[model samples]
Target chain A: MGQDGSVPAYENASKESPQPRPRLRRSVEDGWIAGVCAGLAHHLGFDVRVVRATFVLGTILLNGLGLLAYLVIWALTPQALDGEHADAPRPAPTSLPRLDRAIRALRTSGRDEAFGNVLGGLALVVLGAALLLERHGVNLRLGLVLPLGVIVVGAVIGWSQLDRAERSSWLNESSFSGRRGVLRVGVGLVLTIIGVLLLATQERGWAGMGDAALSALAVLTGAVVILTPWGLRLWEKVKREQAQAIRATERADIAAHLHDSVLQTLALIQRKADDPAQVQRLARAQERELRAWLYGGGQSAETTLAAAAKAAADDLEDRYGVPVEVVVTGDHPLDPDTQALVRALTEAMSNAVRHARPPVSAYVECGASGIEAFVRDHGDGFDLDAVPADRLGVRGSIVERIERHGGTARIRRLSDGTEVALTLPVHRPVNQSLNQPVNQQTLPLKEAHDA
Target chain B: MPEPRATTHGPIRLVLVDDHRMFRAGVRTELDDSLPVVGEAGDVDTAVEVIRRERPDVVLLDVHLPGGNGRGGTDVILGCAGTTTESGAPVRFLALSVSDAAEDVISVIRAGARGYVTKTIVGEDLVTAIHRVADGDAVFSPRLAGFVLDAFGAAAGEIAEVDSELDRLSAREREVMRLIARGYQYKEVAKELFISVKTVETHVSSVLRKLQLSSRHELTAWAMNRHLL
Candidate 1:
């Protein structure tokens, strides 16, 4: 409903990009009211009560003229869920749930801000003031003719029609489709006729009609304030959202990396490696690196490395079928170097989440011996040699990231699953790693040496 | 129970309470003559009144009813469903909710509901469930039953553990320990147990006495460590 026609600011559908095809009906799994307003508010990012208030008031006012339209709209809007989508099939009727969610995903995506606060707050305040002002006015006031009228009309049509998909389908199918361009042409003609009528009635308004219009003419000049540096203002907001998006992608990328490549390779390495002592050493070494990357304190708005790890794990389990379990120690903040190391470990975990099968849980443990992480599955294990050589993550994310931290990285197969392990120094001094600026880009590894 | 084969049974009595006319109509069409819809009401007050008036035995109630999900229906199931027994017992209420929200489902059961079924049961399951509820059998959707049993089984485990622990301790000791563990600090535990702090301490000491423990930490730990927690 925002001007751009994206999902309304209240229902941030594309803001963080809603996860694919997970049927989330009004959470009949959890419903209080029709839960229609709640679902809309959830979709639009508005408080449910705010949506409900709008509906209640709209319904009371439009009960005579436009109520039927509202109900028709309700019957048109798709329910919050698809019931069962391709990603999660519906279970059989005879039994309990046999649904399996196969697609691996990450929940808790970056917070998307589709609407700014000031605009929303201003809309609420103005609506309230105008409603109060209407007490003194008689028939067809200017405010009622413009915004209030739209609110009444939209509320009646939008809220009711939003819930009824079949009505929408029928209208779209029966009316629009069969009649081809006739409906659109008819609607456009009606809108044009209304526009012409409003233009003709411009002089028929009430008191101050001319004087008020003259005074309003002065305010239009003040629009110069915003219009003067239009591109510059627009540029700033765009930059800000882009930066925010980048930060989100980086956080998401780190989670995906950990779950997919590093953990998978380490688990593989752990399984195939012959020397027990070497495996423990490698696993211990990888643990330290993972903690530093995830929990070690950093300049990011994100949490400590360990907390980040848990969030990543939770995100993995919730979004994907992969189950994640975490172990935290010494609730103290960890430095970014440690955080960076943990970031690498987190990537390994992401690899596991993506590649491993059922019953294979991603595990993370941090103690006095540094931090340790692993993705262990009971599914089929892959050969280290057979792993796709051109894989972007192993060459680019794992090896390159560990090398930057002056650590070693390895991948091998375990008896039951594959593991990716990378070990780095636990307590490297800030001065030693201070050669590069914090904002410097990570080096992309050359694929020629990866395999 | 073993999976029962679908039976060509006679019409089952059923009641539906939901505000949506279209959904109600759709449901009615699906089960038109397969089951006899004894009555239907769209709101809370009407739903309760209809159930009481018809006593149809299987009332399909929506969780998101006009007033609220199952507030009045739950009451009817728990406190007002059947005619007064010699013991003044109530009839069982079967809740029909669209959601499988664990809390709502359990609350209905705790309210003496005989069955809980979600609206997504399609038509067949919904019809079958009505007959089962009419027969006085407890019915729950497979997933919903899992949620019920998980909670019930956990509570059962706690009960078994508490019983065993009580058996493990002397009567007086068990009494004092239960009060203490229920968030009665030393002084409060003493007051409730009807003893002075000194006497309570002595009892606590002796209870630790029988349990073979030392220090309050060890006593609390001993109980917790023994899974008395």
Candidate 2:
């Protein structure tokens, strides 16, 4: 520990100290214990083997001072960033083939698997060293080794629980910080149990009945603390994969729709590009179909006021080769009353497009009060009363069509344009308990008018 | 109705802002020669720079653009908030879009645009709206009028606070908007409601001011849901 503290000051005064020096950090990837030896060897510009040999000899001859100093260095120095020594090679294979294979297995396994393998290998190394020293007539004390082993294993169990949440696969990015709290508490509880059991069994002989019971309890607690989170994480991963599969299915549905209608329309449009009328017709038809699919949802049979009016205007445009400007605001389902209103609007609009000048405007609005529409045209103003009975465009089609539905329609000629206004009240369910009168339904007239 | 209000100093200049090159060309060709194209821009940053430099009388701004931190046309209006023409008069903005979404309409209106029109409008009507905007009058298309009615009119069943008179449209204003939503021009609306065209303009302008200045969250949320429709 004293050497670890003095090394940085010595480096600061060396000949290469012209510039600011880098901070000392442990080489975790390269060192076997904690990278303290490798870090010291790099800083001192000495061979790592020489530094490691010095520490081992000092531990044997200097009353285990080297072991205490190594631990102190491990506590004081920070580990290097993850990839700092990624190019460093693994430990050379020992003459013992099985031990080498076990160390190699620890190198390539998952985090939890590597964790167990490292602990097992460390125990094996410690027991073999003790046997070797005993054969050399240097009796190692069982008292120090047994308690330290228990404490190190307990610390490893607690530390492994710290970062299981960081093992990112496709499970979840959110809820990880929240999951860490419960897992950390479980780890702390298991570590405390192991510590208390070790203290209580210290009076009994090591490897005796008390020790056996202590080990059994510690293993059971560790397994429970570890496997609960593992199972939960696996379940979460499965659920996320299922959600992804559902989304892929939806995408396939949309793709099928695009191929069936849109691609066919595009091909037809290309074949008739020389004829402007044919191309325009194809494009408009395709647009209506696509809009219905996109916004109409699943209810193709149900038509709203806006949809009905637009379809009527589009039909007129296609038949006459004339463009009609239709503007709609607010929309309601096309009930019987509003359907009558839409029919009246169609007659009024067709009159403006056929008998009047181009660029006529149609506007419709659906509101809480009722549905109101206007079809205006810039044409020669004519009086409603002066029109002959034979020409029933205004009287029979516009006015009477709406009056039959219990609504009203009016036509007025202004200085610059003629305006037709139609209004239909919305139908709301009557409450019988409130004694409200049910709305009277008007019978349909047999004569239909076409402008 | 041809050049009804004559400009003594020639036609009002225009700056077109839209992201699509084809749409800009189409609008340029469709516009009458009376409305001169002074400049054009494709994004919010270029729009602000061109408007500030050319000082056009009216700007036909597309409500959705590609720049300005994704706030799009609203950011252009704010970026040029205090800009004035060479004569020291404030420049006018007329927003245009292909869709009549209430949220986009309300946001652009609140950002101080004078009017909103759909891209499917007739060329003559677009010319008339541009002239109206340049003359410092608000132009409300049928859909926008209906949106205003839904937001501020009492027909929406919205609760009106005692102190929020400015947030509510009066009865006459509602009538005028309803007529406008029925595709009536201001002149025609004046004749139908037995009022002068100047009074009709006043009602529409007042409604436009309320739409821009009022911060009623309930009105905004109602417009978002399009419950009136």
Q: Candidate 2 on B1-229: residue-level lDDT in tens?
A: 2112324456788999999989899889988778889999999999999999998888999998998979788988998998887766678899998654567888788999989998878788899899888877899987788778667744443334552367887777878887777677899889878999988988888788878888767568876675222
- Candidate 1 off by > 4 Å: A1-451, B1-9, B67-72, B76-80, B83-92, B99-103, B146-229
**Local accuracy of candidate 2 as per-residue lDDT tens digits, A1-451:** 1122223333343333342322344675667666767766654556778989988986887666567556534433445567754544444422354542454455444233323333433443344334323422433454344334434433443343334232222123334643654555467466545644554444444445555455445644553454343344445445555766988999999999989889998998899889888887777667666766765455544388877887788778767655566767667887666766777898888888777776577878666777778888878856654555444644465566677576777777767767787887777543334222222233222232222
- What's the TM-score of each model vs. the native? 0.26, 0.64
Model 1 error, position B6 (Å): 17
Per-residue CA lDDT of candidate 1, range A1-451, in tens? 1122221322342234344322223322122333344445554555656766777776677542233323322222233453422232222231211221110011112121112222222343344245424523644444434433433333332222222222222233333432532333334334433432433344544653553344233222222221222222234446556767988999998988687656865986668599765564455345544544544334342456646655666555545535443433222255655566566666766676677754443333333434444444434666554666544554356656666766656654544455555555555555456234333234454332221
Evaluated with DockQ, which candidate comes out highest? 2
Candidate 2 falls in which docking quality class?
A: acceptable
- Distance from true location, Cα of B74 in model 2, Å: 1.6
Model 1, C-alpha of B222: deviation from truth (Å): 26
Q: Evaluate residue A93 in candidate 1 and report its C-alpha lDDT on the 0 to 100 scale.
A: 32
lDDT per residue for candidate 1 within B17-134, as digits (tens), equals 6777776787887776757777888877777777667655456666556553446456545434444212222333567764424455544655556566655455765666566555
Clashing pairs in 2: none
